[model samples]
Target: MNEEPRLSAQDMIERLEPALSPMTRIRAVAALLAGLAGAVFVGTLWWSEPGPLPGRTQLAFAVFTVFCLAWAGYGGWLLTRRAALFATDRVIAAWIGLVASLTTTGIVTAVAVRRGTGTGPALAVGGLFVAVALVLTVRAHARRAALLRRVRELTGPEE
Candidate 1:
């Protein structure tokens, strides 16, 4: 007679997902959306401007756009691969990302506000990044909580 396993593979995987990469699929999606949107929005504004832009401003735009694209590419790659990042690591990463998004948005929007061009687009792009960052932060916290809960469940209640 064959004995049934205690837990189904799918159920176990679901329970353990928060421990592995801290929900890689969700994090990947967050990164992909933020990076891809930021790159497209910024790059379009950078190129579509009719007025002559300052050399330094152009360089900054190019560098920023390239970095966003690189982030997007990394997210896409993560979807197919596995990288271990603990819950605390995910939280730290999310906060750093949020700060980066805020800073970049502030600087770029200030530039456009002062120049009186592309201000609206700058805000829109920045808003998108900020929103994604917030989502990432919340998700990271949730993942951490879930992982802690799993640990508690596995180890049983405190004495």
Candidate 2:
């Protein structure tokens, strides 16, 4: 039977260096840190509050804290398991982040509007978050395209 040679550890590391870019690492770390901190902060406040609160308010706090925890878990998994994100993976992750941001923004803005207070500020802040996520998503797509182009160039005209 014919056999393909395996890449040595050093060779693998060399190839992986590109996939593990600084920007990718930064994004992963930022997500992990932000999510974790938010979760902890919210949970602490929810636990340490004095006096009774409305049932709905308590539920909201719990739900928000859980959502933050979910984000932290996702970020942790990505940092450890998907540290060396390929071009395709990077694009997918970026899109997921964008969607998550947009969804959160929409929910927050809607809640503020429904409460009949702080609607303007909520909308503005949410819009800014969506804009940032969109920019990141676009950059991820562009980077993936450029990397694919480079790979095709290296692999000759067959592609």
Candidate 3:
């Protein structure tokens, strides 16, 4: 079977740079959605809590709020930075950051479900965030690896 030759990292970057503008726009929309979701979460908590939340649940909410903000910031960075070249290394770093963020969200949600009172709808929303985060992380890692391989091919073995 015939196989296509791989393009070099630089070549790939050259091709992708043109697409970055649209990608940046997409990232901005995602950021706005994430911020909206955070607002909804806060609203739900306030609405649902007929009584005061325990100290731990309060703390979880605080932490999750910050996490959501950070996600927004990341999206903002992607939007503003058209100079953004997804170096293979940067992709790996992004994946790591995203995983850490998602893990924290998962743990907090688990604790809230077990110890704090939560609504079914809220829990489902949290679960959706986790799933989306996982999918994004996987895609980022795959892109990074592909870039790295392309970089290797471009440089080749030194004589």
Leading candidate by TM-score: 2
Residue 152, model 2: lDDT of 60
Task: Please report how far candidate 2 places residue 113 from its true position, in Å.
Answer: 2.5
The candidate maximizing lDDT is 1
Order of candidates by lDDT, top first? Answer: 1, 2, 3
RMSD of 3: 8.7
| Total clashes for model 1 | 0
Measured on C-alpha atoms, candidate 2 has an lDDT of 0.73
Q: Candidate 3 has what TM-score?
A: 0.53
Q: Residue 155 of candidate 1: its Cα lDDT?
A: 57
Residue 147 displacement (Å), model 2? 1.6
Question: Candidate 1, 159: how far from true, in Å?
Answer: 3.4
Candidate 1 yields a Cα-based lDDT of: 0.77
Would you list the C-alpha lDDT of every candidate in the order shown?
0.77, 0.73, 0.64
Ranking by TM-score: 2, 3, 1
Residues 46-136, candidate 1: write the lDDT tens digits: 9899999998689778878876876687577666554334366567667767877887898889889788897889989999999999999
Name the runs in model 3 displaced over 4 angstroms. Answer: 1-19, 36-52, 87-136, 155-159
Candidate 3, residues 46-95, lDDT tens digits: the string is 55887888787676666666666666666666655544365533464356
